[model samples]
Target chain A: MKRRTVGRSDGRKVIVAAVLVSLLSFGPTVRRSDGQDTSAIDRGVRIGIIYRPGVRPGLVMLPRTGQGLDSVRVIVARDLDYGDRFEVITLPGGDSIRLASTTGPRRSSAGGSTATKGATAGALNYPLYQALGADFALDITAAGDTTVATLHDIAAASVRRSVRVQLPRSSDPDFRQAVHRLADQALQAAIGTPGIAATRILFVKDGKVYRIDQDGADQKLVSSTDRQAMSPAWGADGRRFAYMEFQAGKGWLYLQEMGSGKRTAVATTGSALDFTPAFSPDGQTMAFSRATEEGTDLYTINIKNNCCLRRLTVGRFSDNLSPTFSPDGQRIAFVSTRPGLPQIYVMAADGTDQQLFAPFDYGVTGASNAPEWSPDGQSVAFHRDVAGTLQVFVLDVRTRTVRQLTSVGRNEDPTWAPDSRHLAFVSDRSGYRQLWIIDLDTGRIRPLLQQSGARLPAWSPRLSEATSSTP
Target chain B: MKSVSLLLALGLGAAVFAAASCGGNPAPQNTTPAVDTAAENQRVRDSIAAAEAERARQAQAEAERIAAQRRADSLAALARAGEEVRSTLAAMIHFDLDKSNIRPEDAATLDQKVAILQANPELRIRIGGHCDERGSDEYNLALGNRRAQSGKQYLVSHGIDASRIETQSWGEEKPLVDGHDESAWSQNRRDEFEIISGGDNIRRP
Candidate 1:
C-alpha cells in the first residue's frame, strides 16, 4: 500500500527538516515547527505528510488482501478529512514509486530466510519511503485469520501507532468499524484531540433494549419487557431516551431518565402498536410509529405534554413503520410498506409532500426496516433481509450509493452514534443475538453486549452544555 | 201384688238419678235423654275440625313468604356473578393486530374462571372475543373466533370441564366505541362473558 502525506511543501522541505531538528532540541515543549505556526499547530495539527511535489498529502488506504474494499473505509477517511486534521489518499496497485525489492516481497522472503531479516528490512526502507516523500505509512493487513493495522511515522522513524483487533475465528464478517476507530485514534494521538472512541451506542435487540460503549464494551440492558420494546432514540442531551413499549396490550411511547430509571409514557393510544421512536434534534418532540386497525401511521408527540400528538402521515394504502427525523428536524425518513413491499420514504414533519426515497424491488425478498439518518444527515443506514440473512447497508442521498456493511449472519437494525463515525447493530453471529458496533473508517467490529441477547441499539446525541453543567 | 211391683221400679229409677246428680249436674233429666247424648258428641267433633282448619291456614302463609325471599336473593346473586364473569373475561383475552390469537400469559385469568365455574355448577357461560376495526368484516370474524377459542381452550386446559363453557365470535361489527386510535381499538378487542343458564341461583353476600 502507498501512504500519502499532509502539509508537504517542496520549497520548504529542507528548511522544515532543519527547523524540526532545532525545535526538537527544545524538547516536547516546543510543541510546533516553523512554516507551520506554533499557535495553529498547538490548536490542531494535520499530521501524515512528507515533502513531495505533485503528490497529495494524506493517508493512503489499501485493501489488505486485494479484495474489494468495504465502503466503511471511505466513510472513515472522509470523516478524518472532515475533522480538518488529515488528508486521505487511495493507493491503487501499481501506482507511485516501486519499493517491492526493499519493503514488499523481499521483506516477506527475507524474514523467512534469515534471523537478521528484521533489522535488514527496517534498514532498507528508510531511504525508500523518504524518496516517496511519505511522512507515514498506514499498513492495513486483513488476512484470513488476523487483521493488523499500524501507522508508521517515517519522519520520526518509529511506530507511532499500532492496533491488532481480531474477530471470532469462526466468522470473518467485515470489520469496517475496527479499522475506522484505529485510523481515527492514530490521527488523534498523532495530533491532540480525542476521537469518538469513548462514546457508546443505544439500540434495541431481540425486542429488548441495550446500550454499549463505542469499543463494544460494558453492554447493559436498558429495557426487557414481555411485549415488544423497540425504536429507542437518544435525547439530544444524551442523558435521557425515548422508546416504544407495548404494555397492558397498548402501544405506548415512553421517555426515560437514564440514570434514575424513571420513565413516563408519552402516548397511550390503546391497542395500537406504537414503534420506531426518534427524538427531534432539539429533544422537545418525538416521531414514532402509531399502528391501529385502520393502518399504521407516523406521529409526533410533544415531550412535556405527552398527551398532545400530531399525526405526520396519512394515506389510504401506505402503512408507515419506522420514522426518523433529519438532523434539522424538518423532515422525517421512514419505511412504508405502501407499495406492497417495504420501501424507504421521506415526508415533511407535518405529513406533507411525501416522496419515495428508495423504490422497492420485488426481486429482493426481504423487507427494509429501521431507517436511521446519519449524524450529518447526508446518508441513511438501514437493514434488508435478503434470503433470510439480514445485512446492514447505507444509502448515500447525494450519490445514491448503496454500500453493504455486513456480510455474514443475520445483522440488522443499524444505528449511528452521535458522531456518525460508527454504526451499532444487532447480530446473531455469536449463536445468540447481541449488539455489535462497526467503525465506519476501518471496518472493525466489536461486540458491545454479549449475554442475555441484546439488540436494537440507538446512539444518543451529544451532551448538552446545560446538562453537562449540572453536578 | 201390682202395688208392690210399681214401688220397686220407682225406687230403682230414683237411685240412678241421685248417682248422676252427685257426679255433675243432673244429665238433662227431663227432656229426651237420647237427644242430649247425640248433641254433646256433635259439639266435640266440630271443635276438633275448627282447630285443624286454623293450623292449615298459618302453614300456607309462612311458606309463601319464604319462597318470595329466595327468588329475590337469587336474582341479585346472578347480577353480581354476571358482573364478575364479565370483568374476568375482559382481563383474559389479548389479541394481536388484525390477528386473534390468545397469548399464553392470558391463562392466569382463565384459571380464575375455573374456580368460578366449579363453585357455581349451575352457571353456564358463553365466551365471546371480538376484534378491533382493522381488517375486513369476515376476516375479523374469523379472528374473533380464534381469540375466543384461545380463551376457551385455556379454561378447558385448566380443568374448567368444557361442557359448562361455550364460545362465540363477534367480529368488528360490535365495537365498544367508534374511533380509529389506540384507545378505541383496545376497547373493541375484548373477550366478553355472558351467563346462559343456572346463574340465577347464585348466592350473594
Candidate 2:
C-alpha cells in the first residue's frame, strides 16, 4: 500500500498533544531546580593501566592551511569534548612549543590556558604531569595547504610510529566522510576499537523506510507502501524489528525479520491507536504509546506471551507518547505534555517515578518529543521544536547537559546506534524529508538515505551470540 | 382476517353483478321440451368460463405488486450499506504526522466501536494506522504499529476480547490521500477500521 502524508493541522494537534502530555507530568516551574546539579562528572575510561609509566594517549586536531583556523579550533575542541577522551589545552604558536616544559601536569584554566613559548621537544617532567594528573596532550599543525595530526605519547615520550593522514579538502562534497574517517582512525588508535564512522543508519523517509551507510552511501528503501509506517525500533539482536503499519484501513504491528524479509503481525487491536514501539535491552518486551479519546498513555507488552500486557501510565489531563526504554531496561524515556508543553520525561519501566528530563525554557516554548537513549545508557537524543524549527539535541543523563546537533533544516526523530558513537536522524535539508546520520566524534553530517520523505529511525542492537549461532 | 373478509366481499360483489346481468323476466315452469333444457345448460357453462378468466387476471396483478415491493426493499438495503461505510470512515481516528497516537476527542467514536463489537460476537476486525508523507520508511512502519495498537487498546479496555482483533501498520506505504499539503496530510494520518467477519450479511447502515 502507498503511504499518505498527514495534514499539517492534524500534525499540529498531535504535536500539541504530545507536548501537553510531556509537560503535564512535570507540573509548572519546569525549569531546572537549584537542587538539580548539572555537572559533567563521573566520566573516565574503564581500561586498566596497560602502558609503561611514560606512555600516554592523546587526541590531536589538524586543520587545512586554507581553512579558517578559529573555526577549526572551535570544532576540534567541541569534538574532543564530545568524545570524552581528553581535556583540551591551547598552545601559543605553531612551532614555538618545547615538549619538555609541559611534561608534568598543569592546571587547566576555565577557557583554556595558552601554552608558554619554548615548551617543545620536552624531556621527562614526570613530577609536574603527575601533580596535574595529566595523562596526554593533543598537538595540531596546519602546514601549507594541508593538515597533519600527530598523536604524542606523553608518558612514553614517543610519537605514534604511524603517520596521520590529511583529511580530504573542505571544498570536496564528501568532506564529511573524510572527517568521519579521520575521527574514526584517531579513536581506533587511542581505544583499540573500530569507530561508528562506518556504521549505517535506517529510518523512515516520505512514508517509506530506508537504510544508508554511516557515510551516507548505499541508500535503499526497505518497504514501499501507501500506508503510514513510522517509529522503527530495533530489537536487542539487531536482526529483527517491530514497526507499525497501516494497510487497507487497518493498523497493526509487524515483526520484520531482516534476513528472511518476512513479516508477521504481533497483535491487532482494531480500536485504539498504538505506536512508538521500543524494545527492551533483552528484546523480550516492547513498550509503546497507546492513545485514546481520554488521552494518550504508555503501555508494555511481552513478545513471548501475547497475553502479557500492561499499561504503564494512566490519566486524562496529559497525553503521554513516545516511550523509549533505557539501555538497562529499568527506566523509560518519553514525551509528555502534562506540564502544558512538550518536554522529555523519564519513568520506571513499570511506569513509576516519573520526572522531567529537559528544562522548560521560556525562550523555547515549542515541543520536545521523541527521546532515544544512547547505547551506553549515558545520553539521550531527542527532537525539540524551537521557534517552529525542529532540531535534534542530546542530553547527558549524569551531567544533565543538553547539546544541540542540527542547525539547518528541520531535523527530528533521532536514534543512536548500538556503539553510541553516531546518531541517525531525519532531516528535510534536501528540500524533502530524508534520513541522515551524524558522527558524534567528527560532528559531520551525511545523508544516510535518499528517501524523498522519511522520519523515525531505530537502530538495531548488535546480533546476539545465541541468535547468530542458531542461524 | 381482514384481508380474508375483503376477499369475500369482492367475491360477493362479482356474484351480484352476474345475477343482475341475467334477465328479470322468468320462463314458464313446465313449458318447453328437451331442446330448451340443452340451451340452458350451454348458457351456464359460458358464464362459468368468463368468471374463471377474470379471477386469473386479478391474481397476476397481485403477484406483480408483491415482486416490485421486494425489489424496492433490496435497493434500500444496498443504499443503507453504502452510507454505513462512509460514516464509519468519517468517524475513524485521525493520527498525527508520523505518529500513531490517538487523539482524546476520538473517544466517543471508540465507544460506538465498542458497542459495535459487543453486538456482533462473531465479527472480527482489523485496525490499520497510517502516517503522513514525512520521515523514513522504517520509522513510519513503526509509527503505523503505534496507531494500530492505540485502536486495539481501546477495544480491549471496552470489554471486547483481544482475540477478535487484528492489526496491520502500512506506514507511509498506504495513504488515503495523495497531496503534500495539510489537507492531504490530515486525511492521510488516520486509523482505519475494517470488519472482517460475521457481519457481512448485515446492512452497513
Candidate 3:
C-alpha cells in the first residue's frame, strides 16, 4: 500500500521533478563550458545552499547604476523577494545602494584615470558575487526615463536575458510598476513561471474594502464609506472585482472596475440579502449566496447581461454560501449546512452531483466552511472549527485526504495566489487580526501586511500581463 | 344780589343749626347714627380687599399645577420609550450550536416582540443575526442569515406583518461577548431586534 501511494504521488509531481533534474544538470554544464572550476561542484554546494524540497530559484541582485532611480531599484528587489518562488540574496549594505544619493558630487577624474574614477562604487564585482552562489545575477541601469535589466547566469558566465522598460517620469507609481515588470521578466527568464509581484490583493479592513500591492505598499480604499464591504473577489480581467456591501441594513453585490473607479450594484429581485460574490474565471458569471425568507442558497448570475439568475442549491432551511469556482470554471465548492453543520461541498457548475467533500466525523473535526478552490484545481482550502478553534486545512480533491495547514492561533479565510503555491489568510496568532501568507512548498508563513485589521484577501490574477498600463 | 343774599341767609341758618347741634352734648342720639355708618363703610372695604387677595393666590396655584402635569407627562413618555427598548431586548432569541430553528424556550420572547410590533402599528424593526467566532467569516454570515430568517419567520407566524420586520446578518462580526467559550458563544449566537422607525409611537398603558 505504501509503495502504491508513493508511486501515485511521484506521478502527480512529474513536471516538478523534471524541472529539478534539468536545473541540476544545467549548473554543472555551465561550469564545464566556462572551464573556470571543474572541481567547483563541491564549492558550489558549500558556498550556496541549493536543492530545497521544492527548489526555489536562487537570485542575487547586483548594485544598480542610475540617476534618480534609487527607489526603482528598491521596488524591483522587494518585488522579487515577495515573489516567493525565488531565494533572493542581497550583499551587505546592498539594500542601501538604492537608498544612497544618486546625485552626489562626482569623483575627480583629474586625480586618476577616468575609467577608475567612474568605477568608484556601483560597479559589478562579478567574481565576488559568483562565489556567493547565486544561479543568476541581475544588473539594472537607469538612464533618461528608461531602465534596462540584464540577467547573467553566474555559472555559465553569460548573459541569459535583457529587458529594457520605458517608464513615465511624471508618475512615481508608474515608474515603480515598470521596475516590477522588469524584475518579473527577469524571473521568468530564469524560471518558466512569471512572478505575481505586480498583482494586488483586495481585502476588507475596518469594514471598508481596500486594495494594496502584493508587497503591502500603496494601500488604497476601493469601496464607498457609506456601507461596510466584505468578501472581495477579483475578476479574471484584472480590472474588475465584486464585493458584498451592506447599505440600509441590506447586503448588495457590487462590481467595481478599477480603471474608471465606477461601481455598479447587481440587480436582483426581492429584498433578500446577497453576499460572498465570486466571479467565474472568465468573468462572465458570478456565483453568490442569497438569503431569502425561504432559506439561504448558492446562486449564479450572468453578470454581463444581468439576466440569467440560476439557483445552484436547494437548501430549504439550511444555508449554502461562500462559493468558489475551479480554475476551469467547471466546478464550484461551497459551504453548506444541510447536514446540520457547515461542511465543504462540491458540485458541478450547473449544480449537479452535489455531495459532502471533506472526510470528517460529526464532532471530531468540527465544521468546515469558506471553501476556496485552488487555481490548479487540485485541492480545496477551507477553515474548520476544530479542537476548540478554527484552523486552516487543505483537502486534496483526488485523494480525499485532508491536511491541516495552520497550528497557531485562529486562521481563517484562505485565498490562493495565482500560482496556487501560496495562500493568504487571516490569523490572530500575532495577538491581533492581520493578513498572513503561507508558502506551501517551503512551509514558511509570514505576515503579509504591516498594517493590521485586514481580512478576506482576494488576490488578483497576474495583473502585469492583464493590465494595460504595465509594459 | 337780593336773591343771593336770601339763599346765603338760608344756608347760614342751616349751618348755624348744624353747628349748634354738633356742639351741643344733648344731640348725641343724632350723631351716633352717622358714626355707625362710617364704621360700616370701612369694614366693607376691608372685606373686598381680602377677597381680591384670595383670587390672586388661587390663580398662581392653578398655573403651577398645570406646569407640574406637563413635566409628569414628559417623564411618562420617556418611560414608555425605555419600556419599548426593554421589551425588545427581552425578546432576544438565542440559537443552539449550529441550529437555526427557534427554540421553545425562546418562543415567549419572540411572542413579546410580536406583541410589541402589534401594539405599535407603525413601528418597524430589524432583526440582526449574529454568530459565535468559531467559523469562516462568509459561512458565519450565511448562518447568521439563516438565524435571522428563522427569527423573522417566527414573528410572522405570530401575526406580525412581514413588511414591518427586516433582517441583517452580522455573522460573527458583532459579538455580544468576546470570550472563547460556550458562555460567550451562547450569548453571541443571538438575534437582536433594533427599532429602525416609529419609536415615538411606543406608548405606555
Models 1 onward score TM values of 0.48, 0.51, 0.79
For every candidate in turn, the CA RMSD to the true structure comes to 19.6, 19.8, 10.6
Model 1 residue A279 CA deviation (Å) reads 0.7
After superposition, candidate 2 runs with Cα above 4 Å error: A1-193, A205-210, A218-229, A247-274, A291-295, A301-308, A362-364, A418-421, A440-442, A460-471, B1-175, B185-205
TM-score for chain B of each model, two decimals: 0.55, 0.67, 0.66
Better of 2 and 3 by TM-score: 3
* Highest-scoring model, TM-score: 3
Model 1 Cα lDDT, one tens digit per residue, A1-471: 112233445754545444333422323222222221011111122223334544333444432324233343444444454333344433333222223222334322212232122422223254434433455556554556565556667677666676566632222222333544555666665665545543456765556667654544445677745555755778877778877765543456778777656787775544455666788888878887665433567788787566678887774455676778888888888887666656678888778988877545676645666788998888889887676556888888777666777876678778887667677777766676666666565344556654545656776554332321211
Q: Scoring each candidate complex against the real one, what DockQ results? A: 0.02, 0.05, 0.52
Q: Write the residue-wise lDDT of candidate 2 on A1-471 in tens digits.
A: 001112222343344333323422223221211111121111221111111222223233321222333434443434453343443332222233322343334444321233333444333343333223334444444556555444545556565433355644555533444444455555556566555543445676555666544544445566645665766677877667777665444445667765555777665443555777788888888887765545567888887676577988885666677888888999998887777666799999988899988766854556787888898999999888776678888899998878777777788888887678677777777787766666565343556555566566776554332322211
Instruction: Report how far off residue A128 is in candidate 3 (Å).
Output: 4.4
For model 3 chain A, give the 10-residue run with minimal summed lDDT: A37-46
lDDT of candidate 3 over B92-144, digit per residue (tens): 88999766889999998887777777777888888989998766777778778
lDDT of 2 by residue, B1-205 (tens): 9999999998997786567557665355523545777988877887787778778877887788788888888777776864574355337788666455567889888887777667667778878777875543334544566687789898898899998987766656677988878898888888888877766544332
Assess the local accuracy of residue A340 in candidate 1 as a C-alpha lDDT between 0 and 100.
Answer: 60
* Residue pairs in clash, model 3: none
Q: For each predicted model, how many residue pairs clash, with residues at least 3 apart or on different chains?
A: 33, 133, 0
Give the C-alpha lDDT of model 1.
0.59
CAPRI class assigned to model 2? incorrect
